[model samples]
Each structure stands twice: as structure tokens, then as C-alpha cells.
Target: MCGIVGLLVKEPELRESLGALVVPMLLGMSDRGPDSAGLAVFTELLENCNSTGVVPSITRKYSLYIGQHQIDWTEFTHNLQQIGNAIIKENGNHAIVVSDCEPNLLKQWIKQHYPQLHILSTGQTIDLYKDAGNPAEIIDRYQFGLLTGTHLVGHTRMATESAVTPAHAHPFTAGEDFCLVHNGALSNPYSIRRQLEPQGIQFETDNDTEAACRFLEWRMREGDDLETALQTGFEALDGFYTFLIGTKDKLALVRDAFACKPAIVAETDDYVAISSEFRSLAHLPNIKHARIYEPAPEEIHVWMV
Candidate 1:
């Protein structure tokens, strides 16, 4: 089993505390998943930077990987300068690399040259972080509490079906402003991957959750809205799952007809939150009086902020 937590803030004043608020929720679900954890934070790119901080461009955002080897930052930025003015932010084992280059060309350059360094997610608003560690440790190391963002979706993986590594972690993102965290295993991901590959879809890890993330992305690319794409998933994805999808302005929760997985949703005038269990939501602001309920199977709940 894995744990998934998502927060969509309705009140802008709460954005600065997004990470601080979500950490307790993630740590509370440690029993469900202790292998690896990740979070996707969506916010406007920062225009200013201090000496020891990240410099984000207003036009672009990138999620970059450093791997086990270190690269010369001065040399790397110099090379990147040829394509566009690049800004770099280092966080634990990864970096958020932003440039003014068009996203499509930037992606091409990354795939063709820096094949070893993975791009976790690329968008003007989304920054993704994943690592092999407990949720509390990962959060502390990343200093997520200092982050200000519109929303965040986090996951702690149990790793029942894949290797315990950063790549296999949840909250997998394959498209701009899109990411997903799942709580169950798929029955036919290999077959499903085969079908998606021919459509120009790419996958980094063999994790079933990655397949689900890409599938939803592909469907949305084919002109389906979030609700419609998930409806297609209900008929197409073969598994028992509870999926929490985060996009630039939307957060959605859906479960299989079998409803074999657990999910809880809490909503109030100030925010909308979801997690695998009720305890995860206990620490949220004014949560005690929120409208809390378990979503019925096959029922898709979409909240826009």
C-alpha cells in the first residue's frame, strides 16, 4: 500500500504555508508507505534570487536531476547559456533549471545531450521532488516549509511492485503542469505501456503509477478534459487504484469501480484536501469543521482553485 496527499488552496493567503501544512499530513501516512516520497509544488516562478537560492525565470521552469555524480555548475551554465539564459536552483540531490528557451526545444536538448540527467517535470509553475527516504526527512532536507506555492500533491511509496528508488516514487509527472500519485498496483501496465508508446508517449520508470500518469497526459493531449480522460481511464486502466491528479489549476480524485483502495476528502471555504486516511487531514487549518466524507467508487471529484 502507498499513501497519497493533495492540497488545493482556495485562499491565497495560505499559499506560503503550503509545505508546512502538508508535511504533517505526509508524515502521518508513514505506515502506508516508507520507501520513497515526492511532492509537486505549483507556483509562479520567482523573479528574484539571493546568493544561496534558486533563480527562476518568468518564462520557463524545469525540473532537473543531478544523479550520483556532480557536474561543474559554472561549466554547465556556460554551456546552457548558448541556448538561453539559464537559472539554477539546487535542492538536496536535484536542481530546478529554468531557461528562456522554448519548452519543446529545451526538452529536445535535454533528451539528446543530457540523457543521463532526468527531467522530473517541466512547466512554468510545477516543481517536482522525489527521493528514497522517509517523508519527514525528505521534507526537512528540502526545506519545503519555506516554499510558497499555489498547491502541492505528495506521495509516500510502499514499493510493492517496483524497485525502491527516486524514479519509482509517486506523484509522477509526464507533462507540463500535470502530475499524479497513486495508491494501488495496476494489473496490466506492461500491456498498457505498449499501447501508449506508439503514440509518442515516453516513460522513465517501469512503475505502474508512471504508466497511469502518462496515460492521463496522453488522453488530455488527445483533447480530453480531466474528467473525460479519467473516465477513459476507468474503462482502460486495469487495476484497483485511487488516483490524485494535480494540474496547474485543478486537483482531482478518482477511484476504480471496485473501490478497493481508501480515500478521504475534506473541503471548506478556505481549501480542499485529500489523503488516504482521515488522520492525514487532522493538522490542516480549520479542518475540524470541514465537510468530510469518503468518495464513492467510480465517482470522480474535481476541485479547481
Candidate 2:
């Protein structure tokens, strides 16, 4: 069993409270998933402005995690001087390095030099934090209470099919600016992986959910829009799953045709909240005024920011 939570704030004024609102929804699922927790938050995009209101070198962020490894971050930043316009903001063991330089080059540099540094995500608006531990503790360790974002996808995992480690945590990301949290298992993950591995898709884990995440991202990379990619996912991915996906500007939810896994959605004029169960969403602001419903099997529900 696992818990999947997603929140998308439609009102700009309410975006600052994104993390504060999602933490409760996540805590409510602690019993369902006590092994690990993760969250991917999408904040405002970074961009440089000229008199024309646009600049060609839009910013990109790389969320980095140093797990039980000691590295001089000062030297790291000093080294980053070569990659012009790179800036870093740190919070404990996690740091987000923002830059307008080539993200691919930065990622390769970190991997080649600081192999222990795990690149959690890379995109203009996404910042990812996930690890192996109690959900509540993970939340506090990362100061989830203070995160500001347009939307977020969160998860608590009770590892069934893989080792309990940060690398296997949910909110699994493949390509830039996208993440997926799964509440159910995928039966054909190996088959999917077999198809993607040869396509140059390198997987970071053996977790079944990674296969689904990569497959969907790959479809989009191959020119499929979100809706079309999801439709293709319906055909290629097999098993019972309630998926909560977060992109740069959208939060999407879907269930398997059987709809064996549980999911609930509560939408109000100000925001849309989703969880594995209603209990996970009971504490949201104006929750009683929200229009609540259970998503139908095979239905893809997407809400744009």
C-alpha cells in the first residue's frame, strides 16, 4: 500500500501555501506508507527579461542530493563559476542549483566529478525532495512547511517490490519538469523497461513505477502531448495503478481500467486536491465547500495551472 497526494492552487495568491496545505494530506497516509516519502514542487519559472519581456537563455534548476556523503559545497559552487550564471540555494543536504547555462552539461559535470551527488531533477520550475524514512520526519527535514510552488505531487511508500531506499522513493522523475507518484503496482514494468532500455532510456531503479514514469516521459519526448501520452500509457502499461502526475504547469490523475486502486478528488474554486482517500484531504481550507468526487476507471483528470 502507498499514499499519493497532489495539490494544484489555481489562485496565484494561494500558491505560497502550497506545501503547508499538502503536508497534512501526506501525514494522513503515514500508516499506509511508512517506509519512504517524496515530494516534487513546481514553482514559478525562472526567466531573464529584456525590454521585450523575454530572453533566449531561460533558467533551469537542478535539485541535488548528497546522501551520507561529505563534499565541500563551497568548492562545488566555485567550480560552477565556469558555468556562467549558476546560483545555488541550500537547505541541509539538499540544494537547488539554478542556471541559464546548458543543464545537460551541468548534469554531466556533477555526475563525472561528484558521482555521489544525485541529481533529483532538472527543469525550469521543478524542485524534488525524497528519501527513505518516516513521512513526517522527511517532511520536517526538508522544511516542507515553507515550500512555495504552483503545485506539488507527494507520496508515502510502503515498499512492496523494491528495496527501501531514497533511490527507490516515489515521485519518480524521468525527463525534465515532470514527476509521477503511484499508489498501485505495475505488472508489465519489465516488459516496458525492455522496450525503453534499447531506446537509450537509462533507469535509476528496478522499481516498477519507474518503468511507467519513464515510458510516459519518453512518449512526450517523442512528440506526444500529455493527453496522447497518457492514452498511450493506458495501452502500454499494465496493472492496477492510481497515478498522480505533476508537470511544470499541470497536475493529472488517472486510474487503471479496473480502478482497483483508490483515489479521491476535491476541487474548489481556488484549488484542486487529490489523495488516495478522503481522510487525506479532510483538512484542506474550505474543504467542506469543495466539490468532491471519485474518479472513474480509465478516466484521465487533468487540471492546468
Candidate 3:
């Protein structure tokens, strides 16, 4: 079991509070899932990064060490600078590296030299943060109140079928500007993983949620619209699930045919929000006047900015 919450700020004014507003919703669902929690916030490109308004490139990579380990971060970062201009921001044991080099190359170099450091996610607008702890503590540690973004998705995991490692966390990124959080299990993740491996899609964890992430990324690569890709998931994926997918400008919610898992969506002029339960969204600003409803089984809700 897991807790999932998402927010799409329709009003520009609310974007600045996107992270602060979603923290309570994430915490409210903590009772449903308390083993660990994670979140992905889709914010603007870093002020130092270049932008073409299209063909977006990942400008930052979030990574961390496996355990109590130490390396000369200054020297390691200096090596990174040899490749291209870069900035490294350290937070506790994790670090967010902003660099001009391709994210794939940066990740590859880090893996090759510092095998202990594991990358979490990379994207221009998407920054993923997660850990094996309570949702409220994680939020406080990250100081979520300062996070500003157009939209965000979060997950608190109960670790039903996977380890509590950071790599096993939700809000898995499968492609540039794309990531997903799931609340349920996939019945046939192995077969699907095998089929995807040959396609050059990689698996970072045995979690079925990761398989679902790769599947969607592959479908979009084959020229399917986000909706079409999710529709195809209905045919290919066999399970009870509710998925909250985040992209650069859109947040999508989808449920399996059974819809055994719970999901509630609340919409208003200022923002659109989703949660595993109603109480999770109860504390939002101006929520009293919001239009609240539960998404039907097999129904898809896509909110675009």
C-alpha cells in the first residue's frame, strides 16, 4: 500500500506555494503508508541553464551515497567541471548537481568512477527527493516550504513488495520531463521487464512501479500520446493500480479497470489536486469551494497547464 498526492497549480500565484501546499496532503496519507516517502516537483529551469522552449535538456541530477561513505566532493566536482560548467548543492547526504553536460553522460561518469553514489532522477524541470522515513520528517528535512513549482506529485510507500532503499522509491523518472508515482502492484512485471530490456529501456529496481514507468516511456517513444500510452497500459498491464504521472506541463491520473485502489480528485480555479483519500486534500487553501470527486475505474483525468 502507498499514499499518493499531486497538485497542478492553475493560478500562477499558487505556483510559488506548490510544495508547501502539497506537504500536508502527503503527510495526511502517512497513516496509509509509512515505510518511506518521496516526491517530484516540476519547477522552472535553473537560472544558469540554457533554454530553447523546446527539446528540453535535463539540467540537474539528484544523487546520493549508499551509506556512511566519504569522497573528496571538491575533487569529484572539480573533475565534473573538467567536462563542463557545473554547480553542486549538498544537502545532508544527498547532492543536486547542475551541469551543462548531458545527464546520461554525467550519470555514466559518476557510476564509472564513484560506484557508491547512486543517481535518483535527472531533468530540466523535474527534481525528485525521497528517503526511507516518515513523510513529515522528510518534508521538514528538505524544507519543502521553499519549493516553488508549476506542478508536483508525491508518494509515501509502505514497502509491500520492494525494499526500502532510496532507488526503490516512487516518482521514478523514465524520460526527460516524465515521471510517475503508483499505488498498487503489477501482476506481470517480470514479463514486461524482459520485453522492455531488449528495447534498451533500463530497470533500476525490481518494483513493478518502475516497470510501469518504463512502459509508459517506451510507448511515448513509439509515438503515442500520453493518453494513448496510458490506454495501452490498460491492455498490457494486469493489476489494480492508480497512477499519478507528471510531465513538464501536465499531470495525469489513471486507474485500473478494477480500481481496487482508492483515488480522489479536487479541482478549483486556483489548482487541481489528487490524493489517495479525501482527508489528504482537506487542508488545502480555498478547498471548500473546490469541485471534489473520485475518478471512476478505467477513467483517465489529464489536467494541462
Candidate 4:
């Protein structure tokens, strides 16, 4: 009922083509998911903000969603100066804010002021954009074709369970440099939320995918590696799911024991591509020569940037 796409480029030169290559892959999945779509791209760290208008010596970034709301980004940046150096690069209904302030400090400020602005992801390398709309229109609005990154995770949702709001979209995130998109449902999201809420972990949306995303992220924050966190996920998460995960340097995928959802992986010397179905992956370069396979139930696959 959903479409998930991930691309990790191994050859350095292919990095610049990341967006151009992934756009077609995303467009091909328009039928599988027509409600909402999202994309998160991970790039190399850039210490200096170039062409962002307001330059700052930034150490981290927050990909924010304003939806259809309009804001004076210049004045907002001026106001944020009290906390620390802050700058923004606005892109149709979304913006990437680079800041020197702590995550909590900047988050609290935004929540207090522009409550409508939603934090999509927080990190130095990850820039995310997502919203509820026609998949193709959403892609065009966010300018997905211009993205440049080492890897990315994307999703298109059909919204069988929850409301079709931007907040309910997939590619849920927790902590820094981490995000997850799911292709199936979880039966015990409430139980999982109860387990993590006591440990001070927060939930942004009631989406079942968010529960799984935060749970794995919490495990990693507690000292488990990506693979270890996913093993823990296999035990903790209950439901049918094909999860495509993205981190600062890793792209991982896993399925529940049932493998109720569909997932296919295409790998080549230049990049690794994954999607819910092959039609979405047909446009990749030399795709006919790539080694392709369907993941086994509960199998874990991880690709490094």
C-alpha cells in the first residue's frame, strides 16, 4: 500500500547525479502511493553556508516544513540571532535552517513562535522534504531533482489508516542523521510507544512508522550499532513491514518475519537502489546488468556511503 525508494551511490562522481537519478525512480511509484510522498537526502558536511543568503558558521541543520504557511524568513533569522548564528535557505513550502545553537534550544524557540513549522530532520548532512499531495506535484514542489547527496530514503503513502496530513507522511525521523520509511503496518505501535515514552523519547506523530523509527533510533542512541538496533527491532516491533533506513553513512533495509510487504534491491558497481517494486527501479543506469533480488523474510541488508 506504499512505495519506498532508496539510493546509495558508491562512485564519488555519481554523487552529483543523485537527485536526477532518484526523481524518475520516485515518479514511477506514483501509483503505489498517491496520498503523500517524502524524500531525505544525506550529503557530505559543509561547514560554510554558501548562497544561503545569511551566512553562518553552522554545525547542524534542521529541515523544516511550513506547509502552505508563509513566513518572513529574513525576520525570523534576525529574531533567532539572540540564540546564536542562524541562517536559512528557503525552498517552496520548506526550508533548511543552519544553526550553531543546540537542537533543543532551537526547537523550543520554533515551537514557541512558529508552532506551524514542523522539524522534518535534524543533522549536519540530512535535508528532508515531505508533504501530503499528488506524488508528482510534491516532488516538483520540493525540487527533488536538484538534490545532491551520497544517499537518500524516500516514501509515498496511500494513507489507509491515518489522516493525510504532512505530519502523517512517511520517512519519520528521530535524533540526528536518522530516518525511516515503512511499507506495511505495525499492530503494536501503542505498546512500543509506551515502552519508549518513559525513557524520555518523544513521538511526533501517531503514525505506526514513527514508533518503529524512534524505537530503533533509541536503541542506537543507547549504544547499539545500526545492525544491532535492527536486530532489536525484529524483536520489539510487531507487524508486517519493509523498512528502508537512512543514516549519516549507512543505508539499511529489513523486513518483518512475515515479509507481508514487497521489496526489491538492485545493486551495481556505481550505486545501490531499493524499492517496493521493480517498475520503480527500471530507469537506473545499466539496470539490466545489475544484480537484483528479493529480500528474504527478516533478512537485514546494509549499504555504506
Model 3, range 100-205, lDDT digits (tens) per residue? 7777787788899888887777767777788888778878877776789899999999888878877887878887778999999999999899999998888888
- Which segments of candidate 2 are over 4 A away from where they belong? 47-58
Poorest lDDT segment (10 consecutive residues) of candidate 1: 47-56
Instruction: Supply candidate 1's per-residue lDDT for 93.
Output: 80
Give one clash count per candidate, in the order shown. Answer: 0, 0, 0, 0
Candidate 2 TM-score over all chains jointly: 0.96
RMSD of 2: 2.2
Indicate whether candidate 1 or candidate 4 has the larger lDDT: 4
The order of the candidates by TM-score, greatest first, is 4, 2, 1, 3
Q: In candidate 1, which residue pairs clash?
A: none
Instruction: Give the RMSD in angstroms, all C-alphas superposed, for model 1.
Output: 3.1
Query: Please, what are the lDDT tens digits per residue for candidate 1 over residues 200-238?
Result: 887788899888899999999999999999999998899
Off by over 4 Å in 1: 46-58
TM-score of every prediction relative to native: 0.94, 0.96, 0.93, 0.96
Model 3 TM-score (2 dp)? 0.93
Q: What value does the lDDT take at residue 123 in candidate 4?
A: 91
Q: Which residue pairs come into collision in candidate 2?
A: none
- Per-residue lDDT, model 3, residue 240, is 81
Candidate 4, residue 266: the lDDT equals 97
Q: Which candidate would rank higher by TM-score, 3 or 4? A: 4
